[model samples]
Target chain A: MDLDLDAATLDFRGEVRGWLAEHVPRPGLPSMDTAEGFAAHREWEATLARARLSVVTWPREYTGREASLVQWLVFEEEYYAAGAPGRVSQNGIFMLAPTLFAHGTAEQRDRILPAMARGEQVWAQAWSEPEAGSDIAALRSRAERTDGGWLLSGQKTWSSRAAFADRAFGLFRSDPSSSRHHGLTYFMIDLRADGVTVRPIPQLDGEPGFAEIFLDEVFVPDADVIGEPGNGWRVAMTTANNERGLSLRSPGRFLAAADRLVDLWRQRGEPEWAAERVADAWIGARAYQLYTYGTATRLAEGGQLGPESSVNKLYWSHLDLGLHETALDLLGADGELAGPWTDGYLFALAGPIYGGTDQIQRNTIAERLLGLPREAR
Target chain B: MRFTPSPEQRQFAASLHDLLSGADTPGAVRAWAEGRPEPGLKLWRDLADLGVTALRVPEECDGLGAGLTDLVIAFEVLGYHAVPGPLAESVAVAPALLGDGERLRALAAGRLLATVALPPHVPYALDADVAGLVLLVENGAVYRGEPETEPVRSVDAARRLFRVAGTGGALGATDGSAFEAGVLAVAAELLGAGQRLLDEAAAYARQRHQYGRPIGSYQALKHLLADVVTRLELARPLVHGAAVTATARDVSAAKAAAGEAAYLAARAALQVHGAIGYTAEHHLGLWLTRVRALTGAWGGGAYHRARVLAGA
Candidate 1:
């Protein structure tokens, strides 16, 4: 239980820290949501990929160091502590890439991963639609088999980065007769194709962070199909689990936010009321960090990811909200002003709503983890 | 760097669970709370035989030379059962404060129950009347003490505190180890109690029907308990991490998190149990009140959060 990193792990941490201290941008690039910010973040990803730092845990053949999970956590801590650029390729690296490793064809990994890692190609998740937000299996997107591929047509809303991303992945009903999860096929579609139209949506902070991706008979090669036809639900679960769990949201981000909050409070005279909140922010992040450490340990011991990922999602989503709220309160009059804390507060508002709402996570935990009676949905 | 408990630690917890399951701990707690410690005393001896008390004592002291991590495993089980007595004092603080003297030997053998009064932090000795040994800790100075007045009643009946007056010169210096151990023990206990409360609440939600369905099926209640589960889940690792490090900051972090988490669990459990949980006869109150009592037993949220800030 001791936090005794071995010599090798310590050396790895030191190397990452040194690299980040040296290569991280002087002033971090803008958020990867707007056009200018998006291009700048993509360039930053190129810088990281050139150094094999863009995807630390990915296989070395795909522009990564093949770092261990523990090292990846260390990399994250150092990365956030340095105030590095936002991961412009996170949709690809964190979400789709894991699914690719788990279910993609060997050729798919070889073709997609390097470009994704290098930011030459960026990916957007087209998981949600107007009617199939949380109930993703109720998607109406359809794919028709073609000579060497499939023709995809769907209106996918809340497709992050789709406005600028080169490609997107989602589930489309392949068999017209099948309803719900049965007939769906996971397919990667080119956002720049002939019939694809992206409508950028302004988020709360008024940034084009999310977009509605409309595909009208968009062409997707058979090579892009993941798993098998009628198996998109299970394949997407691989991505869904990664999105909600340790991969998408690391403890480092919260730890960094908590540290900044503490600094903000101290700079603001540390009001007695907000003092406890400030301290709790730090404690909450530390607990989550320690909790992740436990998760990493279990994964190292040959344990597979289980329903506990929902636990991670539930814990961090609220911690993020509460931490940002405290920071805003510390800002007082300035809280209403548009700044980092305000922006973060707005962004944190969606933590519980995205990556499977905390409500759904609760259902998963109750039924899957606790063995409670399933809800009569 | 591994954070999961060892297999042996897991086995130890299971064994303790088995013993406590059969011990009818709710009855023991009820007896102890009513100022009758006989059943609780028997439970204590049984735990002692299982090496709970001897975990911290040195090998030379005729005890298992185990670490705070091991003590945390034992204390968590003890807390899950809500076992009564001066546990933090006898099992954690005493061995860390005292040398392997007659008193330490007696504690390791479960023949003596100790209570401590560390002024400013722990101003009143819990269960001082029932304990066989009472010590006052002022600054770094330690001394044998006696109760200056009758038992001071707590909201939780088992917590019978007493103001103690030192009877002799400082017996020894506290050396700070005892306080850390005590705080760690209480943190683990709170985590265990929180887990039990969540478990009971979930079970009740499953069986107790309302509006033509089990209450557990309601998203409202499920989300409520889900949040509780997350807190307890995260809090346990903090307790374990504190046990691993034993730093002032780490211990206080554990205490603050576990204290708040367990308190939240108690509130949610009460909410889930509804009216029946409010009754004196319902065993849920035992854990509910115990959580309330132990929240400030070593250091409350405000105090521990302050420590966390100061330490950071």
Candidate 2:
């Protein structure tokens, strides 16, 4: 009911805002949609990591300031408000951190958490196979049991950042005889190992952030297996939940975009009607902020992941796309051809497809959230 | 940094839910909205007692002064209930009219009812013989008017609309601010109506079995329902944010954005509900009518869009 931040939180916002004003990266870096852009993004993350300002939500034990979730959100808002590149290693900060904290052994956590926090390593998700995108449980990547280790073999497509990643966390079929969901095992495998091949996929935007990985007899020590054997689905679910639920976009970023868009709309000799669309976009952005706050609140309250997280994914992806679309619409022909808006528009299209498609998110909502009966074959 | 409602807000919202759950029942809302003789006195009085009628009014004015955020919560509940009344305008818009203490007190007491009239459609608008005041904007001047007609039947059977003939006693407030707030109020109300339609469709999707399973499970219905929910979520925040920032150093952006969100939510809601949603006997059509009325109720989305563009 109350949207106003308290005095302390507001003060925290001011501090974060002040920090971002100085540290935002320069303009000559690679564009975010391109491979070079991701490299630049990583460099920016390393710079922030050096300052100990990146990924504020994790505990201080892991090189984080151990800031509260509210402060973390403020950090994001301020960071985005400053036009800084998004965290380059989000697969590390947002996804892997939570997964390792929950399931990794203490020694594993000690080894990975600090290094990941300091940007010493980059992680890619090796989940989706050529045939198993939505039905992730049907993964055919094999991990054979061995003395004190496991041997991994098979391919993982849509392996974001795998082309340059130091390591990957993947799910593999460890037992050929077990059921589809039960035979899976989760492992953190070094991408530099022998017999690992990574080839980047060329996207429309010419980004090589996504790659396909072919593993032939790659070895992973049993110590790197996350959780128990056959527990990969549960661990991967935890990762996916973090991917969908806890990840967020700062409202200030969109607000800043709206500010620029309003300027762009008027500069083109357009009428004031575009301002309303901008305002609508602002509303969508603000709503997304509120939605993220709700998710964070649940996490603070120790709530478990539920179907409502799908609602969050479904809602925000469309919101992100809609705001950019409105920006493009306002720009008319100019928006379609050039500038940040065009790139944003293209990137936004992937919002629904990545993480989970809007269709799949809705299915989750229907079957799980609403408890509707499953579709009859 | 956090944008969601707090625990306290949730509790306050629950109060609204509890009160409006009965007041906004589909039947009652339809009865009054179509200008049927139902006054909805019981629900109104209950709301007044619960401090909803005076939520946005300043405490110095013998009201709660909970501000727009509180009003957002109240109206969202009202929308959820689909209570066919000018509750948002009466509470959010009337305070700006500078009406006499008696009128404000009556409004706060749930004994008085008020609604704002813009252009293009005027029903039994001047018929305030049974109510405390009628707020109308004419020739760009906001006037407190009195009408001689009774509440008349309309496409939306749950709301009462009156047609005013002449401007009554001037309440002395000529500022366009109140009028703009009234428009935004309608927008917020429409946001609520859209949500109601979405809920109806979702519920129906769960119960309406097809091919031996809930229709919601089918791709066709799933996509439709998902689209409706997406639109609803998109619009809900816009409306709420507009309310939050309406008193901003600049208000046009919020109003314009809210105007679009309102219309879009209602439109998508109707689309999701399909045929049964269009019937007069059902609450879906009632929401559709309210949305239609509210779409152009004030300056409208097009006009507001222009305003926003001008601001930009």
Candidate 3:
């Protein structure tokens, strides 16, 4: 019946706050707008790694401190409060790392886990081929049988971070004709293969966080396959479920930014409309936090991912985009003058498109959760 | 963290469902409200007998001492049975007027059936006449008043509304949190009504046929039903969250979220029922009527949205 954290959890939060205050890098450490920012953030992560606080939910065997879920949430709250770097290797560590621990073979785990834990290896996703983004089972990449191995040949577009990745985890169709999500295998392929090519795609913000990867006759040893061949569908489903399940972005980040926006507007003594917009933005930010906090509490209690996560994702995306849009709007004509607000607004447009589109999430909720019949596309 | 209702709550909800379904169909409700003429005595007695009117009063005052969660169960049952009365308003708004032991005892005994006498445009004003007094709230102030007009007919045929001319005792200056609580209560009722509509629509679609197949088996109608279910799912958490927050005295965000959930539920219910729902013969229309009344009952969805947008 009560919504407040427990006394012990509150104490834990205070401890985290005090620790973060002492350890967080000083302002001007880096920004998120450029490669230098990304590198600087990596350095910050390495520092946290040294302190054994990064990724608190990972087991102690994985070089983690094995904190409780509540402590994990508290850590995140403090981490975001302290302006820690956004985890650049989230696709690798947050999504794949967990799955590798659970379903991966001993060899696979031995090869992947430590490098991921240490941030020594950067991983990219090869899940979404151009034709296979939403209908992921329809992946066209082929991995044919070869002497003591498999030869891979195909293309994966929107392969996030492929340009900077050392390796990739991908689902490939083992039998070229087995298209309805069967006879496929999940493989870990080295990005430095002789015939591989990675080309960065300029996004709306002209950032190259996205890349198109071409796999041309790349050989992967049989040992690299994580599970039974044809079990790729299951493996990929597990991966996606983990990906969506673990995606936890709180409103604190946006709230911090929005607070800064408000301070800027207020300090400048701008229009009264700007005050109203700031208030509106704050409301949206707080609403999102409440929803996310609810989700976090659920996960802390060992709850599985459900339709409601879509609700959270859908809500936060819309709220984040809305607040940023408001920020841009409040800046008026000057808001479109290529400043922070304008760039943020453009970035917000990608919110609905990334992870999964809002429409797609609704469809998932409808078809999978609500048991709705699929719409003929 | 747990989202499921408790066993006791479930049991009480089941009992309520049985009582309400057996005793308070739409026709029966309308007939009773219109036939009773003992200055609200019969209605009050009936509510007490059903334990409906005594839910929120403290146990020390001969009441059930139940909070918003229990009230929510009662409301869902009431909505399901189309119980036409001030079940929500009396329980939600009466406590605001109970200043001393005498007033508290009267409310606990169901001698008082209070309604929030918000204006015609206010959505939850439909249950006004059953109350001995109507509490009106505006801009975080409370003004207890009498109705300026008789109860106006509502689409649900379960309740009526009236306009209050803004003249009554100042119910003491304090934050209008109670009124906000009432609004959140209406949102809970709306959640129930929306869920009922969704369930009914789903059942009907499963039985109703088109081209020799159940309409629900068709993609178009299935997705429509799914959309309604999604709205129901989304609204459920918001309503529950609001009730939790309301008990904790955190009203602003919950109120806003509840308002949106109720408003969306109403709209989605109407869309699901299509033309049949627009007609009065079907109960879907009745729920829609209730939804419209509830959506505006507090401060209207727009006001709550604005409040929410203003960062409660």
Candidate 4:
């Protein structure tokens, strides 16, 4: 097992490092959840797209450089290490992009991918409804087949970035007779559609981080339907896996935070009581980095991600929470104030709740990874 | 870069697993604790023949000249089967310490056995009665010694500990890297032990029923075992990664993580197995005790944490 970057990866890393060094904002942009900050992050994404750094792993046809997974990870490391702004287009770039690449038709890829890569049409997930959170298959959203398209009616809550996003992608029950997983249709709907309503939901940090999307007979063309009409469940699984895996949360983010945490600790004269906790945060981040490297290596070697994605989700969620918690603890009384650490801590708290809750993740790990008996439904 | 083991490394571990699986390791462990070292020695010789003892030794020293990653793989299997020996010393530590010495060749060839005492934490040599050589490490120096043995009982019966009292000629200055190697090897063992506990607990959870359902179906036990599995799986990358990047900080981080993971697994295993697991008759107790002893073996969590913090 080797950890050293190969020559090509090193070259890619050098290129990314050089580009980020030159282009990363001198003073970092404000929180991407804020309206002004969202615009700034969108501009940053445009800047990255111009350099073909926005979606390094996508094919050149999609305005990308067709980088390898290792290269993408290296790019992410460099991106975070450079203190670059958070990706305002992450819901599009990370969540929907992979699903589009995997299941989208040629026309869909041609239309949606470039817009996503260029940050021209930011996307948000419209998966969870008010009635359906963890049990997404129990969603009551319906998509009635009309003449050449489907008329959708649903209320999706906790739709991240939906407040300002141009489009959303989610599953809608296409057949009235079918329930649970079958007869569901995955659709990419315009948030500005005739019957669409977007209501921003203020997050714990008092920002419109996510929104509630109300779709009342919103028409989506058949071409916007991803995968097969009755195969949305299968299609959505790809997005779900990506959400829990490398796409949404890269180890680079935590490693950078851990580095910041260590710096904070050092600044505090290295209090002996907090030393182990600080050390643990760093070690945990390193473990995650190595673990992601392992996962990337496995994926590169043609291994499919299964329930192990749940394991990755649980690990990173806790790691992020713990890293930020330690940072705040090191901050002492000042931690109570609204600063980077406190803000980050608030965001970290959302990690376990989103992408799927820790409880759901644990259940998945137990049932799928450990071969435990599923509870009686 | 490939962070996972190569096929050959996996095959090596698999073969070791097969051999240990058939060796009646629990019986051997019992015999060792009963002061009958023959069975454990025979098992150790079998492992030695597999070139486990020779892995870290240089090829010029009549050994495999393998890296720490290979030793990590071998040591993991040894821990999985709960193999009884000074494995870290003979397979990892002593090889790095002694290098191409005449005794090193014998040790690699399974002709001789060795134990070590790196005071003040490890002032006692384990299985010293069966060892043909003993090395005492102190203050960056290594010395040959014949210990005046006072038997010290460990929580794990298989570990025959001894307090050494002797002085001898210095062999050479001890390399700090040897200690780090030892820690990494022990970490691998802890990872293995943790895995075994998880496996045993999972199996028991499936079979053992309570309140009209299998205990595994209960969310409490399920979450507990799941957490154990998560910790073990995460600790694995740390151990293997530390093997590749053998820095003091990396090794210490690995040791700390592996130790805590193993300790968690031990606790969870016992809790899942209930009263049966606490009894010595049950094989789960073997790993439980082994995990406890090994958690504080090379350097405890506090020591490794301090090392990581200092290095950070």
Q: Which candidate is the best by DockQ?
A: 4
Task: Rate residue A284 of model 3 by lDDT.
Answer: 51
lDDT of 3 by residue, A280-299 (tens): 45555555555555556667
Error of 4 at A198 (Å): 0.8
Sorted by TM-score (best first), the order is 4, 1, 2, 3
Better of 2 and 3 by lDDT: 2
Selected candidate, larger lDDT, 2 vs 4: 4
The reply for model 4, stretches above 4 Å from the true place, is: none
Order of models, best lDDT first: 4, 1, 2, 3
Q: Candidate 2, residue A188: CA error in Å?
A: 0.9
Computed on alpha carbons, the lDDT of every model, listed in order, comes to 0.89, 0.69, 0.66, 0.89
DockQ of each: 0.77, 0.40, 0.27, 0.84
Stretches off by above 4 angstroms in model 1 are none
What digit string (tens of lDDT, one per residue) describes model 2 on residues B1-312? Answer: 344555777787798787666454666665554445354656777778888887756667687867666677667677666665666567777777654777777777677777666554233452243346667766666676656466655555455566765465554645666655665566566667667766676777778765676677777666656655655654565555556667432244444444455556566556656776777666677667776765655555656655554554
Better of 3 and 4 by TM-score: 4
Write one digit per residue (lDDT tens) for candidate 1, span A214-303: 888888888989999889999998888788879888999999999999888889887899988889889999999999999989888898
Reference A-B contact fraction recovered by candidate 4: 0.78
Tell the DockQ for candidate 4: 0.84
lDDT for residue A90 in candidate 4, whole number 0-100? 90
Candidate 4's TM-score reads: 0.98
Tens digits of per-residue lDDT for model 3, B1-312? 344456688888787776655553655554644745353344347657778777877788787888776776667666665556675667766675456566667777878767665443353454555567677755545677667566667655556666665575566553655665566666667767767766666666656666776666565665455555544554555556666667322344444444455456566656656788777666676666776666655665445544553443
